[model samples]
Target: MNKLWIVLTYAVFTVLLIIPLVKMTTAAFSGGLGALGDALSRPEALHAFMMTALVVVTVTLLNTLLGMMTAVYLVRGNWMSRWLRRLMNSLVDLPYAVSPVIGGLMIVLLLGPGSAAGAFFDHIGFKIVYAFPGMVIATLFVTFPLMVREVMPVLQEIGTQQEEAASTLGAYSWTTFWKVTWPSIRWAVIYGVVLTIARALGEFGAVLVVSGNIINRTQTATTLIYQDVENFNVTSANGAALVLAAFSIGLMLLMEWAKKRRGVH
Candidate 1:
């Protein structure tokens, strides 16, 4: 009896989520393989998917490194890194509180080519806030806190004493990290990276503002899907959306592998 109620609750929630997914897939395959093939082969769709993949890769690298450094500083630094810790931690909450569009707008306010600092960049042939650079920056701003948040708590749980012990034993910085610190935090780092990749690939609002929605150029997969839907090309939109969904699923699988690796170690 109790098991039945629990099953019912989950079944209801599962249906809620699966229904939309079913609709999306239905839209994708309603016209069969021919439509799917056409959507996949479209140059614009291919370009958007490739651009999204590149952004995911870039964001993962940059955020993982910076977030690791930030995590280490928060845990081990001596000179009132506490204040900086507070600041960094506070920014972690921005993704939840601030809208992505607002984040993109903030970037434009500082980096738009029309601004003075932006003029200097323009003079140097570095365009921002309406190009690829701007799109990446916007994605970074929105995805910035994910890696830190994922890893910091794990770092805190591991404590700094292991690092201290390694230092006392004359282990070099890199060696100490690989030997002592990384073992415990590595899974968290991997999870963070996967999450950031997902976020960067799916990031729409922030990129929309900064990318100028430039099709076949600055159009990311998410934005391309948006344009397709808006233009009443539901089939194309679903096809592009499925590509993003596949990307998201791939990262999630990577995260599962990382989790297993963590368990093994």
Candidate 2:
């Protein structure tokens, strides 16, 4: 009966969360699945969809490479490196504690119109603020710590034995990484990549400040959602929102699959 009560309590909590999500999904698909499909195919909507997709893909790839390298180095290096790792670990807390708008402001202060980097970019005729590059960089900063945290623990857990074993077999570092190291932590890499992608896709406060939201040109799905909702185009906004929610669901499924695969192995 104790087990039964525990299960009942968990079930109640699950239902409380799941009920609203199910309603939203149903509402998104109302007028039938065909309507949802049609909504997703609209031209501006497609642009937003593709832009967000590119952002997720680009950010995930960048974060994975950077995170994997940083995690491995932190695990393998010396005393100075230990200090650097501690610094990075402490820096990760900033994203969680700082307001997104504050992050945007920080970037703007350093890269905005009159700042030194901004002036250099102006001299080169390459605008950073209110542009794609700025948006991508800002999103990268906000979402990066998630990837680092996810991958670092897995790297720490796996340790150097597998790497040492490969090295002793006359394998060079790159060869050993591809041949042995990668296989051991592939799931961790994928999980961290997915988390990075999800966070990048949903980023609003930081992205908005940099993107300039110039409608049909620079507006990402997220910023587009905000613009639509602000303009009272709730239907279109909800449509954009549903696409984002679908991406979120896809991430959840991917994480579940990764967990199952790890269990099976």
Candidate 3:
């Protein structure tokens, strides 16, 4: 009976996930590798890849570094009020609850041409909306919570006992962190960063809302795929989508590997 249930679950998962993935894989390779290369080698497609790389790299770096700091503070900082801590914890989940398109709309409201911030940036020769900066901001907003959530649990599990021990032994704050805390949280940080890379790579709705999807300027790979599909360039779209799907799979595998290495269930 147990084996029967396991088999049933596997069959269900295969039907829901494996079938569609196989279909996409077949479509992506329909024209063969050479055709895929040709599609991606186009100038617009290449520029879109470059733009996406820029956004993913920037977002990953900022989120990983800032997220580590935030998790450390949230877990270890002594807050005078419990409500303030609860509020901060809730804010970390904001991106999960808020729609990505709404996130983009919020950015536009804050930085669009009609706003004072937008005017000041324009006067200073900076562009935000419909540009590279806007894409980065959108991606960052959507992916921000991943790192914090991943590292926060690890921080809480490890606790401040070791850090306090190191400080009592006369180690400086930076020394304590480098020698004690970092070793434990490194795996969680790597997991967070891998997830961030995956999320930033495939972001579409938020970026689309702000990017204007200019051909060689602000278009990321996801937007380029959307445009290609709208123009009925299915081959090009498939190629780009295949690349992103491969990236996501690779990052997911990395995350699983990290989890295994850390002996996480």
Candidate 4:
């Protein structure tokens, strides 16, 4: 029965995921390689590609740094109260539960055109909403949990004895972390970063709400696909979608490899 269930689960998964992906890929390549190149060669599409890359890379770096610091504190900070630690843990999962649309809306309400913060920022000649910065923030908020979640378990498993030993041997705090703690958690960090890239690359709802989807300005690859579909440009839409799918598949493969490597080591 368990074997039957496993087969059935694979069937369902393949039907739902693999079939659609195949169809999408077929649609994308329908016009051949030249057509795909043409679709990507357009100025707006090129801009969207660059913008998406920039946003994903920036978010992944920032989140990795911040998430590692937070995870270390949560794991090693004996000074923190139990309640505070629990609160922090809950907050780490907040983005997971909240809809991305709501996350974007929160950013808009807090910093969009008419709000107090918006007005203050406007006076300072900086805009948040309807800009690149807004897109970055929305993507960051939506993908923030991945890094912390990935690193926390590894940290817990490794414990702090190695770190303490390094310290007692006259290593500085930074040296101790680099030589002792980081090696153990490096694979976890890589996995988290891959997940972040995957999430950030495909982010839509939150980024849409905040980015205003300005062509050649704030539009990302996802938004470009959305726009192309709305305009009934199936070829262009499929091309953009195909690019995103390729990105996701590549990153997912990398993530699985990282996971397996982490387990083996």
**Clash count, one per candidate:** 0, 0, 0, 0
Model 4 local distance difference test score: 0.92
lDDT of 1 by residue, 1-265 (tens): 9999999998998798677778888999888989998987899999888888888888778888887887777667767566886886786778768999998888888888768988899999988878878887888888878877888888889887888899999998999999998988877887888888888888999999988888888888998998998899999999888777877888788888878877777
Q: Which 10-residue window in model 1 sums to the lowest lDDT?
A: 73-82
Write down the worst ten-residue block by lDDT for model 2. 73-82
* The 10-residue segment with the lowest total lDDT in model 4: 254-263
Q: Is candidate 3 or candidate 4 better by lDDT?
A: 4
Best by TM-score: 4
| Superior by TM-score: candidate 1 or candidate 3 | 3
lDDT of 2 at 224: 82
Stretches of candidate 2 exceeding 4 Å from the true structure: 1-16, 19-43, 79-81
lDDT tens string, model 2, 49-82? 7777777777878878887877776666655566
| TM-score (all chains, Cα) for each model | 0.92, 0.86, 0.93, 0.94
Q: Give one digit per residue, the lDDT tens place, for model 3 in 51-139.
A: 99999999999999988988887888786366777788889889999999999999999998989999999889899999889999999
**Which candidate leads the pack in lDDT?**
4
Off by over 4 Å in 3: 1-8
Return the lDDT, model 3, position 219: 95
Q: Relative to the true structure, how large is the alpha-carbon lDDT of every model?
A: 0.84, 0.79, 0.91, 0.92
Query: Between 1 and 4, whose TM-score is larger?
Result: 4
Q: Distance from true position, residue 101, model 4, in Å? A: 0.5
